[model samples]
Every structure is written in structure tokens, then in C-alpha cells.
Target: MTEPKIAIALYSYEPQEEGELLLLEGDILTVLEEDASGWWSGESNGKTGLFPGSYVEYVDEQLIESLGLEQFEEISEESNNTTEQDLTQQQGGEFSGQNINDENYVSDEENEKDNTSQNQNQQEIIQTQNFTRNIGGTTMIHDGFIWEEKEPVFKVTIGKTVKRKKLRGMKKYTAYLIHSGNFCVTRRYKHFLWLRQRLVERYENVPVPPMPEKQFQGRFGEDFISRRREGLNRFLNRICEHPILRSSQIFHHFLEADEYQDWKMGKRAAEKQNKKEVPFFKSITCAQEVTKDCDDEITEFKKNITSLDKCLKNVENVATDLYLSNYQDLSASYLKFSKAFLKLGSEAKGIVGKNLDIEGKELKERGKEQRKIFIDPLKDYNRLIQVFIETIKVRDQANFQYVSTHAKYTKQNMGELSGQNRDKLLLKQDKSDRMTNITLAEIELFHYNRLRDSKEILTNHLKTQIEYYRKSSERWKKVKEEVEKIPVIHGSKKLEGMEDLSEPELFDEKIETDTEENQTSNQIDKEIEKNDEDNEEEDDEDTDDEDTDEDDDDDQTEETEEIEKEKDENEKNEKEKDEKENNDDFEKI
Candidate 1:
């Protein structure tokens, strides 16, 4: 098992493991004691306990050497001031020890033999006290300065006092220089571990040494140290240049708006926990996630809706009228339209997935492309129709001008003819008197000829104009018909009725009545003809009876008596027949 790199402060320290716990931001602590398990020895309050080795990272040997040298220098500086009483006090009680506070520390008269030395030492102590009490209007301390708010950090055993610079801007400024104010300066600390992690992230395939002690010596040298310092400086620069910090604190509200909003939202959510419905725009991106404008999502949804509408309209336009009338394959078409709508809606939803309000190139390009493909066509079609209508109007105006000019010219030239011709022209011009005059026919003849020629020219021009107008009108009519049939995407009727008429059965009653009347009239005419034929048949039968009566009398016997009576009747019938025949012959002749 790897040894712990730093010492950990426990209630007790014992010998169970070999590891070190970090202290003072960059201090490496060695395990004084260890056992078979993964526990390391650490000391606190004169008691030792087995601490876990895994809790510590081993420091490099070179760092330990440098620290020892620094320790030596500090030991020399305090050699004169070191007291057995001070040591005793540190070992006793709760051991509130780090740098000795004046409240708990003093010197014996024997130890203060040099009065000048004593004065210099007292002055130095006073100066150190003042510096530690306040640094740039903020409480700061040197090494081992323990405070209730701050953790105990081991001070440098020996170092020159750093000059206090203004640091500009604010009277009270706390520089975030040290990683942890209370921790020891050690090679194998969490801060160093973070630095190592950053290095690994930046440079792939970085060779890490198995033994942190050896590895630290090899890698974290002057160059790495320089890079780390540079990185730290850059981080500080970013904080200094931060908009909130650079500008007036009046803008602090805006900087804290997000946090304030989140807190407010959280309170609202807690208050209304029982209410299931969330208000629109209430649900927001969490603080950890980036937020974006809601308008983008709305626009994207609109585009998708438009696209689906277009697909539906195109399907309608392309579909055959006969097929639409009978509605064949309607199920498939409906499914297709539904699928398209759903897919487009899904795409629109995803367009702002996660960070819906964030701006990016992909979103911009998507919006642009959607407008071009879906919006431009309808606009172009509308513009073309408008232009077509205007063109037709212009053509009509031109035709009107040509007709008016021709009429005016025809009227004006007829007035230039000679007197007799002029008189004749005047007669012809008058609709009421054109045929009345044949006087001075020669002048009239010339004028009439000219008028005829002019009339022919005018007629031809009018005919051509009329034909052109008809063609243009027909063209426009067809176009308008097509456009009307084309489905209007939004707010248009879903199911269109037949173009022929809304109700085809409206004329059914009239048609039925007409059919019935025609049938009745034909039947009556046939009946009348049949009646005439029946009358003629009756007349023929009477004539035949009369002829038979003359031949049957004597041949009848008793039956002949009956026949003879019949023959008497027949004789009368035959006389009537002969009279009728004579009348028919006369009529024929």
C-alpha cells in the first residue's frame, strides 16, 4: 500500500500506517507511527491514533528538504526568543498552539538580559502584531495565527516580511491567493492534486510516476512551477476584470439576479407544492444549466407548423380531383399528413432541447433555411398574381385608347367631304336619314367609300383587340380558378365540397315534374288515335252486315226466318252503305 503523503489532525495519533496529511496549503506530513492495517500515526493533545493512509498524499522528498531548510532559518530567527515557558504552555491545556499570541506568551527577566535587545524585540513583536491585526483594512495574519473564523495554518519558520502594496481600487480587499488559509503548505495536498489533474487534462498521455515522492521531483520542477504561477495570475486577472467587480456595485443586483430569481422560484415552488399546474414561463433552467430566450423555441415551433402546412397543401394540390371527389387512399394521405406534422413538431421541440434560449450558429442557420424553403414560395406566388392582374389592366387600358382614337378619327374626316357629298355623308351619318337622300351622289359616293375603308380598318382593329382581350381574360380566369382550388394553408377548410354545386339534388323536383307531364301528354294523344280507329272499325262492320243481309233470306228456312228478318235489316244497311260509298267516291274525285 502507498503511504499517506500528509498528516491528518485527529483526537489521537498512533503507529498503524505510513502516510502524510497536508497542512498550511502546501505542507507534507510524515506518519510517525504505523501498523499492519492501512492506518497511519498522527499526534494531537499528546494522544496518538491510527489514521487512514488513504486520506493523505505523499510529498516529494525535494519539497521536504526545502521545507526543512526554511524551518532551520525560522528556528534561528526565534532562537533568542525561544522560552521553556512558551514550550510548556504549548504542551499544556487544550494546546491552542500555532504562533504564540501575546496573551499567552511572556519572557522571564533572566531571558531579557540585553535591554537594547529587549527593546528591539518588543518593537518587532509590536510591529508583527499590528501587521497581523489588519492587512489593508481586512483582518489577516502571519503563519500560525489562529482565529475563530479561520483554520490554523502553520506559518513559515523563516521568511522576510512582504511589503504591503496598495492593491488599488478598494480600501478593504481580500485577495484569494492561498488555497486554504488554515492548511499547511505541503506538496501532497488537495490543491496540488487539483493542479496535477489540470495538467493531465491539458496534456494527454502524461506519464505519472508510481511513487509520488519521485514523481514530484521529476515533473513539478521550475517549469511546472512557473506555469502554475501563470495560471493563478490569469485566474486572478479574470476575477479583477469581471464585469461586476469592474463596474459600480450598483450593478451588483444584476449580477446576483440569477441567484435571487432561483431563490424566489424555490420559495414559490415550496409554497405551491400542492398545485399541480405550473404557470407558463415559470419553469426555468436550473442554475447549473445555461438558459436561453423563449422566442427561439416559439419561432422554431412556428416554422415546423408552417412546414407541415406546406406538405399538406402540396399533397392537396398534387392529388387528382377525381381521386379527391371519391376520396381514394384517404386513409394513407391522412396518416402521411399526421406523420409529417408530428415529425415537424418533434423537430421543433428538439430545436431548443435542454438550453432552449442559448444562441448559436446552428439555430441561426436552421431558422434561415426554414424561411427560405417554406416562406419564400407563398410570398412569390402572391407577388406573381398581383403583377399578372396589373399587366391585364394595362392591356385593357391600351385597347380602350385604340378604340376611342379610331372612333374620333372616323367622325372628323367625314366632315371634310364636298357639299353634295358632305350632305350625303351627313345623311348616312344620321341613323334616322341614311336611306332618304340620293342627291349629288358623286360627292356622297367618295365620302361613303372613304367611310367604308375607315370602318373596315376600325373593325379589324376592334376584332384583334377583342380577341386579345378574350385570350388575356381567359388566361387570368384559368389562373384564378387554379389558385382558388389551391388550399389555403392556415384557417382553410379541411374538407372542401364539390366544385359543381353544393346541392346537386336541387333541380330534381323540376326534372321529375317535366318527365311526368311528357308521359301524360303522349298517352293522351295515343288514346285519341285509338278512339278514331275504333269508330272506323264500327262503320266497316255495319257495311258488311248490309251486304250479307241481301244474300241470306231464302236460304235460311226456320233459321232462314231469322235470317230473313236479319236480311230485311241488312237491306236497309246496304242502302245506307251504297249512299256512303257514293259520297266517299265523290270526295276522292
Candidate 2:
């Protein structure tokens, strides 16, 4: 075995058998078998690894001589046409294989002749392969490079043939292989070829749409290239350094030097920008203006919300206070009513007992006149009952008025607040809905109960007062009956008393007279009839006059009140209208 030559093939040298003869072909070298029938090994500096003689051929001097005369003759012609200065310039580097085929056994004369003929033959071959034409034709290219037409297209063929005998016994072999499929070399090669084909198709012979006159008008039609040239350079230099184009080393080098830094700086700046918090995007055209308007509206809405909060608080306070006041008044009236009822019960009991006693009382007729002594204060009892009923009516009316007025104002305020606060709740629909949930009826109920409670308290009170009046009348009647039971003498002249009265009888007579002096007493027989007729006439006349005046006055007062209310409302509306007109004019400006 021979060691591969280190000279010339240093880029592809490899060890071989120590005794093998390594032959040379220019900078290429090969190891030969002992018989020298063919080369066993060879190397080239520009290629990977060593090559076997089966795949490589040597260009020795003998082989060069055998190349024939034409190719050499063509080279000689081209070389001769050039000046000596040009030859010197072209031949500045070493040409190492000038004597490669100079055989040691051949005569110098024959060698010279052989060299000359060989050179001529070489020239013809060179010339034959080097013809140039002035022909013009377009050659559509693939990937804009690589003249693929001259090379045989790579292909592999498959025929419908199989190792039937071997596969026959392995029934599931195909299925097994399919199930175990992976990205082995075969699959990878197929995928790589598919991707390559796609890439090639993408870059090949693309068409451009024709530009319309409208699109290419003015400077664009003729000077498009000139005008765009600077932009094109800037794009190539500045923008090409972006990651989309920078992946390829070949492309990366195409960018101008300064543009590389500019692109990097731009990316850094973009990243810095991206790091900042971004606002949510909306589709509004005047987004900034809309946002400002929204902010202003929001500020105003917040102020309104504050005002509403205050109003709600006030409502709560007022409602609570009104309820409490109504409750307190009702409670106070209830206490008063209770006391009056108790007193009335006592009086009624006393009156009933006294009436029974008075019905059993004795009356005496003396002298020529019928003088009656009676018991019971019936007139006082009737008057007290009347007073109690009148007081009750006054109390009930006052309570009803207070409750009605309160309910009216609360309901009106709720309506006005809902209307006036509409602007504040424009964006807050849920809040508005909640506000609408408040009811006029609920406030009405509260006021209604206040009146009911007050009425109940007063009714109870009136009942008690009536009872007390009855009781008082009963007690007075009892006292009157006891007084009338005492014996009395009407004669003042000692008459038929039978002798001079004793000291005791005398004192008794004095007491009887004094008691009679204190009473309007038994003389009411005449006075009662006369007074009854006169009182009846006066009462009828007074009642008729009162009824007529009350009806007339009530109608007149209602008409006056209605007229005044209308006037007030009209004035308020006019003032509001003026304010609104002024606001509208200011807004126009």
C-alpha cells in the first residue's frame, strides 16, 4: 500500500498501502495497482474524501497527448492572437503539468512530432465545444440560475416487480412496516424533494399583471425606474436587514453596512415601544375625540351620581322622620283617647245608676200649686255627649289632612327627580332600572297608615270621652235626687203646723227654705213649655242660615284656590322656559 501524495491534494489526502505507486494528474493524484491496469485510488483538493479509480480518471501526459490536435490548435490560435503583455499577465501563476506525458522511452524527434499533432487535435476538440453564435432567443430559467437544460434530469424508475417468494411467507410485513413508519432517510428524502419542488415552483417564471394607464400616469409611466431607484436602494439597504430577509447569509450580506445598524436600532426602538402599556383599541374613527367626550361625560355623570346619592340620603332621612312623627302623633293621640274612654265609662255607669234612682223618686203636690221635686241631671249629660262627638271630628280631620299632604308631596318629588336626573343616568342603565324600582305606592302606604293610626287613636279617645261624660252626668243626677228626698214646707206664716214649732223643727224649716233658695226647682212646669217653643223656632232659623252660607262660601273658596294655584304654576313654567332659552342660545355659540 502507498501513502497518498500530500502535495497538491493536501485538501483530499488519505493513507493507503505503503508500497503502492501513486501516480499524478496535475494537482490530482491516484494510487495504482502493481499491474498498473487501472488506478486503485485518487484525490482532488476541491472535493470531499478520496475517490476509487473506478469513479476517477487521470489526465497524464500520455492521455493529454492522446487528446488529439484540434483542441490544442484552438487554444494556440486564441493564445497567439493575444499580445505578449497579455500572455505574461495570464501566465503569472504556475502551470505545473507542462511535461506530464513526456515518455522516457520515446525519441525527442518523435515526441516533438507527437506533441505537435496532439496539440492540433486538442485544438479542434476545444473549438468544436466552444462555438459562439449571434443568435437571440429567450431561455426561461428555473430559480433564475443553473443552466439545467444541458444536464440530464435526475430520475429513478420503478417497475411492478417484487420478491414474491420472500414476501409470500411474511403476510403482514407491509402492514408492519407501515405501522412502524418514521422519519428515516427514505421518508426524509421524499419530504425534502417535495419541499424542493414546491420552492422551485414558487420562484420560477412568474407573470406580472399589466398596469393600466390610470395607474401609470404622469412620471410613473416613463421615469418609474428612475424615480423608484433611490427608494429601491433604500429598501434593499435599510429594510432588507429585517429578520424576514436576514435568515440567509447571502441575503444578509446584500444589505448596506449602515442599514444593518439602523434596522437593529429600529427593532430596539420598536421593542421598547411595545413594552409600554397599550390602550384597548376601538373601531371609532375619531377615537381620541370620542374618548375625550366620553371622559367629560363620565366626569359629569360622576358629579350627578354624587348629587343623586345625596338626594337618596335625604329621601331616606325625610321618609324616616315623617314616619316617626306620624307614629309619635298617633301614639300620643292613642294615650289621650284611652284616658278619655276610661273617664267616659265611669260617667256612663254613674249616669245609668242615677237614672234608675231618679225613676224611683217621690214627688209631692202642696197647696193649690203642683210642685214637683225630681232627681237626675239629664240636660248636663246630653250636652257633655255632644261636646265629646264634636272634639273627635276635629281631631280626625286634622290627621287626615297631614297624611294626604305628605303623600302628595312625596309622590311629586319622586316624579320630578326621575325626570330631572335623566341626564345623569344615561350610561348607567342598571342604576336607572334600580331607581325605577322605587314605587309611589310604597310611600303612599306609609302615609296611609299614619292617617289610619291617627284616626284609630282619635276614635278610641272619642269613645272614652263619651263614657266619661255619661259617668259625670250619672254622678250629678245622683246628687240631685238625694237633695230632693229631704222634706220641705212651703208655707211661711206658721199656718196649721200645730202650735209653735220646736227648736229642732224651726231649724229644719230654715234649712228647707235655704235649700229651696238654691234650686230653680219645681217651677219648671210653666217655664219648660214656654222655653221649648221659642228655642225650636230660633234653632230652625239658625240652621237654615248656616247651611246656605256654608255651601256658597265653600264653592267660592275652592274657585279662588284653584285660580291662585294655576297662576303660581304658570309663573314657574315661564321662568323655567326663559332659563332654558338662555341655555340654548349659549350652547349655539
TM per prediction: 0.14, 0.14
Count of backbone clashes, every candidate in sequence: 45, 41
lDDT of 2: 0.31
| Global lDDT of each candidate | 0.32, 0.31
Q: What shift in Å separates residue 571 of candidate 1 from its native position after superposition?
A: 59
| Cα lDDT, model 2, residue 367 | 8
In model 2, which runs have C-alpha deviations exceeding 4 angstroms? 1-429, 439-441, 490-589
Please give the TM-score that candidate 1 achieves against the real structure: 0.14
Q: For residues 324-363, could you state the per-residue lDDT of candidate 1 as single tens digits?
A: 2223223223222322222222222222211221222222
For 1-589, candidate 2 gives per-residue lDDT tens digits of 6654322111111224453332221133434331233234443323333332322222334334664334433443332322111211211112211221122224468755655664565444433431221111112122211121322222121112112224566531100000111211111112223322322232111111111111234432223322222222222322122211222222222222124465455434433332221110100011011112322333453354346445545654553444333333333333323222222223332333334323212100110011001001111122223332333333234334433443454466543222212212211221111111111111222234335534754565466546655765776676687656645667646432122333434212112223331121112222323333433443557777897899999999999999999999999999999999999999999
User: Candidate 2 versus the native: TM-score?
Assistant: 0.14
